[model samples]
Target: MTFSVPSPDAIPRPDPSGADAEFWSALRDGELRFERCAACGTLRHPPRPVCAHCGSRATEWVTSAGSGEVWSFTVIHAPTLPAFIDQVPYGAVVVRLDEGVFVVSNLLDCPVDELTVGDRVELVPTRVDDELTLPLFRRA
Candidate 1:
């Protein structure tokens, strides 16, 4: 029998200079982290060197509570990227955390029809390979 994985391209590429590098590193270590602006106390996503709100370089990292709600999503009927061909019809979601930052992640552990905006979900890591750990979500 052929061995199979749920999503072969689930792992993201590494960015050494991006603000998200620390977040990805933490996720690889089994922890979830968010960026918090020291000047405005605002939370933001896709990480940044300076706070978007106040342009402050001063920021801190906070571990996420690991729960969020689906803000938006799309069910891929076709693989837009060649790397994702094996995982077609999967759901990609924008999750709004309890702390207010939104993360782009994949929704897993259920049928595609079951996904909906505002659905509660939780973070779970999937092993794409021995070297890569990916953050995917499941119904909470």
Candidate 2:
């Protein structure tokens, strides 16, 4: 049997737009920022134009403290991207920020065995390529 692997470019990348653009811009500036609805006091991420809770268009961007708790995770046993083949078994996680927004990121700087729900974590910048900077998490 033979199988083909996916390329590294198939990996997800951030789209620079609206509030999402600010999130990526902040990462390049070495910070983590989140969006909050000015009308309903709801916090959101993956930055959208409207509040998910109250359907309000009044949204504002605020800097997060870069600290959060691991909500859930998946350890990739089979790497889909060719460049990440050697890094199989890496972790992808959903983190609940202290401010109440969940951020999706990869967990790094520690062994996968130690990863667990509720583990305290902090955001760190990861160099994806020459021009890309991604937010990764590590054990706090």
Candidate 3:
């Protein structure tokens, strides 16, 4: 399967704030960054200010291995936005990273029906624009 890079104007951009700003910036540099709690050694996604496990305010950004397994997924047959109309039947996967955090991203370069729950996947950073690049996944 071949995926076309979307035009910057055709795709939605992230509006990063606080920790999110740092996360987005790292992606632009071709790195996948996630939050790790200093107090409890827990990893979390969506870049929270506090750790959910230990309620620790001490957190730091860590570069991920960018490899994971597909825990769950669905093929989007309907366009949720007009910009995605040309991208229907894409696999939206919930990948569980080896570090134990999960991220929701698109699974590319494979047929949707061929994806499985335990399928190994690796990050493929795709530039959405000059300032924003997304961490997409492909079969490992």
Candidate 4:
């Protein structure tokens, strides 16, 4: 099933800064990236300036396997924004990436009521525009 999302102009866009800029750039290139500490090898998301584990300032972007399980989720029945009104009843999922990090994104192509805590899923990139591509998910 194909999922519907708000157009690039219709939704808020992330303003990538510092290390976060690399994360967003990888998405535009159709790959999902996370940061790994150069010192402790701890992987993290939402990119940070320093490693949470070792407090190291050195980090590197690593490509994800893009497979995970649904750790948690919520089905939105109410429209929080006018742009999302048409997409109400969408599943917002917290995916536990195979690498042991969790990222919050949307789950697509499945009935919201049917989603389970351990459902296997894979990355599905939805190109919002030339500069932005949102990482959505579907059942593996």
Give each model's clash number. 0, 0, 0, 0
By how many angstroms RMSD does model 2 differ from the true structure? 5.1
3 Cα displacement, candidate 1 (Å): 16
Better structure of 2 and 4 per TM-score: 4
TM-score of 2: 0.80
Model 2 alpha-carbon drift over 4 Å, by segment: 1-12
Q: What is the C-alpha lDDT profile of model 4 across 1-140, one tens digit per residue?
A: 23477877888788878888888888888899999998899998878889978899998888998999999988887857877777777778899999998998887778777878999999987789988888888899
Q: Looking at candidate 4, what is the lDDT of residue 109?
A: 73
Report, for every candidate in turn, its global Cα lDDT versus the true structure: 0.77, 0.76, 0.85, 0.85
Off by over 4 Å in 1: 1-12
TM-score, every prediction: 0.83, 0.80, 0.92, 0.93
Worst 10 residues of 2 by lDDT: 1-10
lDDT of 3 at 48: 86
lDDT per residue (tens digit) for residues 1-140 in model 3: 33455678878778878998998899999999998999998988888889999999999888999999999988777857776778676677899999898888887777877878999999998888788898999898
Q: What is the lDDT of residue 10 in candidate 4?
A: 84
